[model samples]
Every structure is written in C-alpha cells, then in structure tokens.
Target: MRNRINEEITLRKLEVLLAYMETGNLAKAAEALDVSTVSVHRALHSLEEGMRCALFRHEGRNLLPTEAAHVLADVATDVIKAMADGIRATRQAAGYSADHMKIGSLYSLTIRTVPDVVIGIKVRRPELQAELVLGSNADLLFKLKQGAIDAALMAMPEPDPEIESIALFEDEIYFAAPADSPYARQASIDLRQCRDEPFVTLSEGFITYQGFMDAFRIADFTPNVVMKVGDIFSLMNLVSGGVGYALLPGRVRDVFAHKVTLVPLSSQYRLRQTIGLSFLRRRERDPNLLALAAVCRLAMRVPS
Candidate 1:
C-alpha cells in the first residue's frame, strides 16, 4: 500500500538520490555526501524500489536520470527546505536563538552597569543583537517575570524562589544638589540637616526612591518633596536647574558631574544598593542568559 512505500522511503535516501542526480555519477555523488560509492548506489537502489519505478536508464556503465527522477528531485528539495524552516521557527517559539535578545534595566544603570553587561554579551555572542528596555526597578522586574525580557540589570531584590540573581557591584545613595549649592562644598551631608529643604525625587517604584525613603526614615523626618520625576536623568536635571535637591545613586555621579554634585550621606543615613543581574529561574539554562551570567561573574572579579 502507499503507507508501506512511504515507510521505506527515508529522507536520507532522497538526499542520496538528489546528490547522485546532481553529480551525474555514483563516485562523484559519494564524494559530495562523504559516503562510499557502494553506499550511495545502495541508497539510490532502495529509493527506486520504494517508489516501484525505474528512475534511471542504464547507458552502458553510466546511469542517466529519467524525467520522473527530475520531478521527484524537485519535490525532495522543497520538503528538505520546509523541514529546516520548521525547525528554526520551533526554536524561536521556545525562546531559543532567534538572532536577537532583550534586556531590561533601571535607567540609572545605563551610565555603567548596563553598558558593561551588554558589551560583554556581544563579545560572547557575536551574532546576537541586543535590545535594551529601561525603566524603574519594579517595572523591569515585572517585565523579567512576564518573559518580556531575557534578563534585567538592577538593584538586587530580596530573595525569591522564582528569580535567580548574580550580584555585580554595590552603589550607595548620595545627596544630589546643584553644583553651586552650599551642601556641595561639605565633605558629607546629613539628611537631617536637609529636613526643611525642598527636594525632587524619582517616583515610587525606583530603587533609589526606596533608598531615599529609608535614609530619611533614619533621619527621623520627611523631606519637603516639591516634585516627583519618572527618570533619574530628569530628576538630576531638576536638581541642576535648582528646582529642588534630590537623592541619587553614586553610579550616576560621573554622568551629571558638571551639572550636579553628589555629596555622600553621613554614616547614620548611608544606604548601599547592591546592583546585579536577574533572570527567571526556569530559564537559567537558556544560552543567552548563561552567557550574560558568565559576563557578570567576570565583572565581579574585575575592579569597577
């Protein structure tokens, strides 16, 4: 029956038949397929037997292909191409290699941490393209959990079973003020001293925002926050323009060094933010995530 014929005709046999047809000789076909001439001849013979047809005509020692052989060769080519495409599509759907990777991070990290990780990833995976999605710590963590990004670079969250983290470096929050402000001249500023000063802060979800609240809590009073911005750069801009003072991580000190001055907080109000890489525990074995983790591990060894 047709089912029995189908079972006998394997994709390997079709590949052999195509090779023989293209090369026009059993020896040449064997060379192309890296198989012995006898093996190539046997595969072609089995293919003809499965189809129950004379696909070639023997002209002395040479076997010339028949019109039926040409038709079958065309169909075999299409089948092989389709199967290859299907495999690629399936891998992409499973979050394997699709030639691109997405990484999420806090906007503050764009100054150093994100760039370092991304460059290292590119060095390890030369063909992979990377896309960066910047947002608050909570926004990035949400995106990481939803599978919208492969990984995130941000302040490490409290331990969770669903997430795996690799600590890269630690940064501290500082009192950020205009370059011309009196606080910028001091070796360190006390949060309690600024209790009555107007302040600008990043919105609720940012990692720096949490540090801001914690430091102020220790100082025992609420700051007079005049405005809340969504990003660190804008908040720094507001501080630079003398709209209000703000608290920021030390990471951005170099970025806005000329515009704003970051004065260290006194010992009582000092808070350290541990920055690191985070990904879903289930995807720990993913190739891209593995490469990213390796990069972070290397970074930990180097002085920052």
Candidate 2:
C-alpha cells in the first residue's frame, strides 16, 4: 500500500531534503549548510519517515538520493520561493514592507538599456523606489540567486532551472580599431587578419570575454593579448590609442564613434549577443516582477 506523507511537513525538512539532493552526500551537504553531519542524517531519515517512502539509499560512504528525492527537490525550490513571496505579500498588506525593486546589470548596459529600462519602470510606477547594481555577468547572477537583486539586464547565460528570462534583442559583435587603421575602412575583416594583431579584451568574468575568445577559436588561432581591462569604454580607449584591437558589441558603438571604427566580423565568426531581463522563474507571476517585466517588454518593443 502507498503510504501517506506526514500531514505536518515542515519547511525545514524540505530544505534538508534539497540540500541532500544537491550534494548527494550527507557530510558535504552539512558543510554547505554549516550543520552537523549527524543533524543532516537525522533530517534525511525524518523526511523519509514523514513521507513513508525511501528518498535515499546507502552507496558505500555516500547517501545517494533516489528518484523520489529528485522529484521532491523539483517542488521544494518552488515551495520555498513561494513561501518567501507569501510572507512578503502579507507584510506589505500589513504596511510593514520594504517597497523597493532591486535590479542588477552589466556596466556596458549603463550607457543606454539600463537607463531606458529604469525610465520605463518609473513611468509605470511613479512612487516605486529602485536599487540598481552593476557587475560582471557572474556577479549579477550570484546576486540574483541570493535574492539580492530582483532582475538583471545582460546577455542570457546558460539556462538554469531556477531562472526565467525575456529576450529583448540580438546585438552583433564587431572588430573595433583605431579610426585611421586600415581595418577601419574594411567592409568586413577576416579572422586571419586578427591572427597577428595584438588584442585588448575585457577580463574573463565578463560575457564579452567569452565571445571574443570564441571568435578567435573559429579562426584556429590565439590572439596576441597585450592588455585586459574591466570596462568596455576602457577597452575601446585602448583600441583608439592603438594599444590593441578588440571584438565588441555594436550597442556601445556610438560612444566611441569619434575615435574608433567598428567593422562587422566575418560570417565565420557569426558572433552575436542576446540581451534579456532575467529573474527567478519562481517569481514569474509575482505582481511586482510581472510589472517590471512588462515595462521591459513595452520599452524594448521587440517582437515575440
């Protein structure tokens, strides 16, 4: 006979179950959560007893979570996120709330997209307060996972179950060079040409860094690197001063139009970046999140 789960399942038990599911080892999960291994073991056993089902099985020194554990883990993330949102809603209704939207973005976006998005949001929510954060792609994602930021404007990274995103547009990457360089006058530059040129790039943590590296890989060569900067404008400044060439997106082209020239990368490179607004998928239906997403969509005016 199928057994019934305990009627009074606590959130703490679910949290433990998830920790075990993720680590697949009691000791490591305990270390991750800063709890005792014995406590972690007890929690897992209590979860099994409460559900009256085997959620894990012994595998040597490891406690391997079973299919049932994985299934519950899927629901656990949503349940935990929903419960947190629920508390916020209740507190807001009781007039004990922090009424501000926190947003994160890349430094490259501060020039246009981020400012436009903020303007659109204020138009819809005149009394709304906003807290903005600017960082590398990885940094913003870490903040989003920790609930430090409600959303971000960036090149959509790989899909993660806990995240939801709305794509706004595709921007092409170009070879940026000094205005007087021969490459500046080329209709399109061949990757073979880049083989010998010294290149400047954003640091490894930035999304643009990967795209730059990928383009060079397609050419079957490594760029002769001369310097790495933290921001795009600085990278462009290095290009304009003839420090080194860089592959950069077109969105920021206008800013350096006077001193630098942008040439479309060849078809082989096929480099492009997709900009989007990303947030926790669990908050997809959240009123405030939905409202902000709507503002992003309307302001962007992109097709579905």
Candidate 2, position 78, lDDT? 97
> What TM-score, to 2 decimals, does candidate 2 have?
0.68
The residue-by-residue lDDT of candidate 2 on 87-111, one tens digit each, is 9798555323247888898888887
Best by lDDT: 1
Clashing pairs in 1: none
lDDT (0 to 1) per candidate? 0.88, 0.84
Error of 2 at 297 (Å): 0.9
lDDT tens digits by residue: candidate 1, 1-304: 4435556588899899889988899999999999999999888888888888988888998889899899999999998888889988987676676678889888987876677778888999999899999999999889988878878988898898989998888888899989999999999998878878999999999999999999889999989999999999999999999999998998888877898999999999899999889988887888888888898778656524
Q: What's each prediction's clash count?
A: 0, 0
